[model samples]
Target: MLRRLELLKELLLLIPLGKVTTYSSLASLLGTHPRAVGAMLARNEDLVVYPCHRVVMSDGRLGGYALGKEFKRRLLELEGVKFCGPERVCKESVVDLKELLS
Candidate 1:
């Protein structure tokens, strides 16, 4: 559990500036399941610092947001990420700045 906590903690810091990542991608970074990442994010206590809103669904869908789906959308929008296309892929966005947030 401690190791998983560390992984979640580290993954939280990887979210980018003005861009979002999918749950599956994050889980893959830790060699775990997307559901596990989602569970960790859901139980996150340092929300403001971790920025859980930057995580979305792999299929470009906004999945379960512990802070509320609208809040997630608002947060992402503030970062200049907009979902579009028939599948709702993040569109018209700048570069994926994962390095910045990390």
Candidate 2:
């Protein structure tokens, strides 16, 4: 479990400056659950290095952040993550985990 969490953090660090990914995507790629990903992220101590804010819900919702939703939204915005509406990120902006891992 600890190893997986470490790998998850490492994977999260790969999220590019302007891209985002869903929690479900990460969980699938990591062979874990979305809630576990969220739990690990919630306890992550290195916010700047991990870039956990780039993760969202599978449905494109901006999911919770250790810092708060607005802060997460602002960070994503600063990184040029596009939104589909007021609260969801555009589907096109989602990062492909397979491509990233490969």
Candidate 3:
């Protein structure tokens, strides 16, 4: 379980600046459930190093963060991620899962 968590954290690093990915996307690539991906992100201890905030919901909704959802949103905003609405991220800011696999 620890090893799986470690691997998930490493995957979080693959998310580029100003871009985001969905929990389902990460799960699809990791061969795990989307809830498992969210669980691993919630357990991340070092937000600066792991950057779990870059992971959102499949529909571009900002999901929960260890700190807070708004804080997570703000962090992404600082990275230049544009929000399409109050809590929805712009679709173009999302990174394609296939791109991350390569």
Q: What is the C-alpha RMSD of each candidate to the true structure, in Å?
A: 3.4, 1.0, 1.1
What's the CA RMSD of model 3 in angstroms? 1.1
> Candidate 3 on 1-102: residue-level lDDT in tens?
787787788788888999999999888877889999998888788988988899999999998997888898889999999999989999999997667688
What shift in Å separates residue 80 of candidate 1 from its native position after superposition? Answer: 0.9
lDDT of 2 at 88: 96
For model 1, the stretches where C-alpha displacement exceeds 4 angstroms are 85-102
Q: Which ranges in model 3 have alpha carbons more than 4 Å from their true place? A: none
Ranking of predictions according to TM-score: 2, 3, 1
How do all models score by TM-score? Answer: 0.79, 0.94, 0.93
Q: How accurate is candidate 3 locally (lDDT)?
A: 0.88
* Candidate 2 stretches greater than 4 Å from native: none
How many clashing residue pairs are found in candidate 3? 0
User: What lDDT does the true structure give each of the candidates?
Assistant: 0.71, 0.89, 0.88
The superposed Cα distance between candidate 2 and the true structure at residue 10, in angstroms, equals 0.8
lDDT of 2: 0.89
Per-residue accuracy of model 2 over 25-60 as CA lDDT, tens digit each: 889988989999999999989998889999999889
Q: Model 3 Cα displacement at 56 (Å)?
A: 0.1
| Pairs of residues at least 3 apart in sequence or in different chains that clash in candidate 1 | none
Mind giving the per-residue lDDT tens digits that candidate 1 earns over 15-92?
Answer: 667777777777766778989888988888888888777777776777877778777777777777877853344644
Residue-level lDDT for 4 in candidate 1:
80
